[model samples]
Target: MRFQEDSIDSAGFVLRKDEVLTVILGGGKGTRLLPLTEKRSKPAVSFGGKYRLIDIPISNSLNSGFEKIFVLTQFNSYSLNRHIHRTYSTNSIHQKSFVEIIAAEQTVSSVNWFEGTADAVRKVLPYIREQKPKYVLILSGDQLYNMDLSDFIQNHLADSETEISVASNSVPEDRIYGLGIVQTGENGFIQEFIEKPQDISQVENCRQQDGSFLANMGIYIFNTKTLVDVLEDLSMTDFGKEILPKAIREKKVKSYVYNGYWEDIGTIRAFYEANLMLTDDIPKFNLYLEKTPFYTRPRSLPPTKINHAIVNQALISEGTILNHCEVHKSVIGVRQFIDHGTKIYNSIVMGLDHYGYFDRRSGKIPNGIGPNCEIRNTIVDKDCAIGADVKLLNLKNYTEYEDEYIKIRDGIIVVPRHTTVPDGYSI
Candidate 1:
């Protein structure tokens, strides 16, 4: 169904949001995003300066009028839970709307943590079923994209025979691996499903007319009955690996092709690359659009103060003070303090939460980038204290390394949260 160009509200819609529930899978331990995910859950990881990775999915859902959401979290969810509680609050006007956290808990029937994507939903089946939703929208917490989810719902409702609607996007042939590939007939019904095929022939078979293969976006809209029955009948762990392929054969599943910018921020390299891409002259994924604005916790901080700093092609957030530094093509987060003579290029400096003083009463050096530091192609996580004359230039030709104060991946250094890089240290 072609989505209405006019107000989606006035458009001939077949369903209302009251009949649907949204579930955001926060995933298990994000091992690939190590040090960044060390202190917080993958969904809670900071992204685009001030927002968390999970905000992308939640914002999309909320903007689509699906306000009642349950964020399923597993590993290190304390920060995530706090962020949600602080950022989103339900008032008397929208009493029925809420953004709640559903942490993994041992029940009488099951006593294990979420084994996989499908298993996580399986364990929450009781809670979900109680709501009596006709359709369930499942989303990934760590993906970076903006989707009008009403289109997904309207597309599913347009075809009454479709029991499940899987969101798909065309990906280049070389990038088809590690993604659930879909083969669709001319009628738009998914004919076959493959789980990360290594063979080139299999990928070519799933190629669309646009010279790209159909890859699952990890976004699904399943009929409530179909989802419950499939979970009860199979002992599957993951949806992409097990359930999706089998469902294509037995159930009436269709692909809702999304021709928009979407990136799965799963690995460290993918995360770093996606963050840096936002520094472009005109980023593909725009966050400044008021019509589809990205939501986050609002802090009333003072305007950023720049003291003779040469910042070009950089995104400097609020409450940052740049003093005689040259930052090029970087993303400086909130409340950042960069001293004089610091030359940061192609990097991400995640600012601190509080101001740091040089007084001995504080007992610490200070937070943020110190003087005479030369940082390039790096990611400085939140609340880091970089002493003077520190060079974060990984001189070796290595892909990854783990050290006391830094972690390097894909030749990009990552200084984890609260890390203190002493003076005169050359990494």
Candidate 2:
């Protein structure tokens, strides 16, 4: 399904598809999400089960009638580039709608990669100028949320005085520690901005009537001229830390409050929890919403086959074979093979890229969990081979631990991609 190319805003103004250009920031290094980002970029990391992190923002933009999207990527972008090309490339019929990948290049003028988020966009101003979009909507590629950006664009257009509009969400004081906080005065116009405040008292006045502070969602709608003017200073790299604070002080910046489920899948723990949350009866971020469905690369695989598996509160994707295993509150990704007697609880098993029948015959520790294995509070990345009787329970409850095969961060065990756990192995 496609959104209309033209629509009327709330203030009775025609909104054209070319008016806005969407830029999704494929994050840098992604050190926090280690192993997962080891081989692929942050945006290319698998999420929920079948979809990549980049799919979220691109899906939202397409659903919101803004299709001229540019994904800025730098480190480990091969998989990201391929995924975008395979999934988002439109047919020739939709000439104006395109999802282009703009990788950081070393030109004669500059011999460096993207310094930061702001710098990444600044470097791609030449490509953006070609589109001649009136507004530029910047979004994070690693966030999980379902937002109607049409409303966000409409809100920004409703107020002619506003040059930049930031999407803000009301979060508790304790949750605002590592998030950008904004203080808004009359008519929801932002008065001050602080990035990742160490002290809560620094923005005490920004607290709302409900006692929640407005935290930046890292979603922004900027006027093209305003964006160009602010990025003139090359030293200002990050939007949250530098560009936003300066914009608030000088320009008419307003906060568009977003009351929805949003999660930053930046760390291993956060990624694990966010995947588990989807197993809930009524998940905050609904993937089943028919109107705003999450888009991904479609696969032509057989339906999942479960042979008397006792599944409860789990989200198991297609092409999986569960043989008499008990799955409780877990998210099983695509093409998984769990043998009989295995019990998985509070875990995320990122299934294989392809069937391992040939690999199984070769006897090189076939992908997927073997029989009698016990997995609890763990995350198994793609193409892993867990042998029989292997236990990844993290029984000692260590805050942090690492070895050649596995890592425990924030008490959750993580078996990195392409790892093999031998028989009877225990953690």
Candidate 3:
């Protein structure tokens, strides 16, 4: 059942395993996600109620049998580091596995900070070089998907002549312009690469098969020697817009067309949409596998309860009590308390020392807060005392919502986590 080391051949092809290391890019500030990212880094954000965005790559590494992982982070790294320590600890006394968090400062350099993805790698080149891993696997921290990188690395090694291997996907014409588009030959040898081009229609038609173009999935594997050379050769370090492209010239740069469930949760809308995917009748991804498990520090609480509530397609964490409430297509974090007559639809509620809910109905309390209110199509931030029967929304029924705090985007109310609003006030 172990996918580790030498037992990783589902397709006979295997990768260079002697010195393999996985590095997760976890330092970026997700500005597009605004209010949510304002508090914490993208990788540290809560995902699927119980997991953080860092779990995707880390889980894949663990399941694929690559435990030597180093997450490179900068902003709000404390939370990410804490989570990793709590979940994938390398205490030496208990487990032999190691999944540690490394940052830009981990290197002995006067370099202010990791400038880009490439620069980040450059700063941490000492860490990788110290391990002397035969190959390097670079990954993103804010993506949502389940992948088997063992297959990817094995494929790369089988094509041993290949210098760099990148995972790509088939993106829509409109979405193509947002990603790095590549022209791969029938032999899977990538020819031309474009970054955020203006005209995607022509590019879409230029493709040979089914109007599909290969867009970068932000996943790359590089030979150790090749990586070192590129990191030293390139003045401005960045993988996406720089290193990989330069390495492809005269070098054996290959492409792996990935046809799996993958999503870039870099924005609030994308983050919200990915959670709703769990609502499907038969979900595209499942995290309930015993063999390829996604490990997390368990809350050690009992199962959640439902009493007179319509709970559909939601991932409710341990010790949650839903009494006469309606939570559909949402992610409720650990130990959350859903009071009676509350309706939380298409939202994310994170509950670990987070703020309580509030009602801004109408009072002199900064933002008139209320208690025990009816919530509908509204995202209430954590940690506020809401009064009974107070309404903080102005939708469908209520017309005059206070637009200063929560702006209505596409008819969805986004309540940033952990902001207090006084009771009895309606927004």
The candidate that wins on lDDT is 2
lDDT computed for candidate 3? 0.70
Error of 3 at 225 (Å): 0.6
Off by over 4 Å in 3: 7-18, 91-96, 106-108, 205-208, 354-387, 390-411
**Candidate 1 deviant stretches above 4 angstroms:** 1-13, 91-93, 358-364
Assess the local accuracy of residue 124 in candidate 3 as a C-alpha lDDT between 0 and 100: 82
- For each candidate in turn, the TM-score is 0.95, 0.97, 0.87
Residue 312 local lDDT, model 1: 95
Alpha-carbon local distance difference test for all models: 0.86, 0.90, 0.70
Please identify which of the two predictions, 2 or 3, would achieve the higher TM-score against the true structure.
2
Clashing pairs in 1: none
What ranking of all candidate models by lDDT puts the best one first? 2, 1, 3
- The prediction achieving the highest TM-score against the true structure is 2
Model 2 has a clash total of: 0
Model 3, span 1-427: residue lDDT tens: 3344454444565443446789999957777766667667888887776788888889888778777788998886777788888887843422345787887573344547877888888788888888878889999988877888877876676665788898988876667767888888777777877767788554664464676778889998988888888888547667777776676775787888888888887666677677666666667767676766666665677688778888987888776667788777777777566667767666666654532332334443221123256555554444433444556455464322335455444344555654544445455
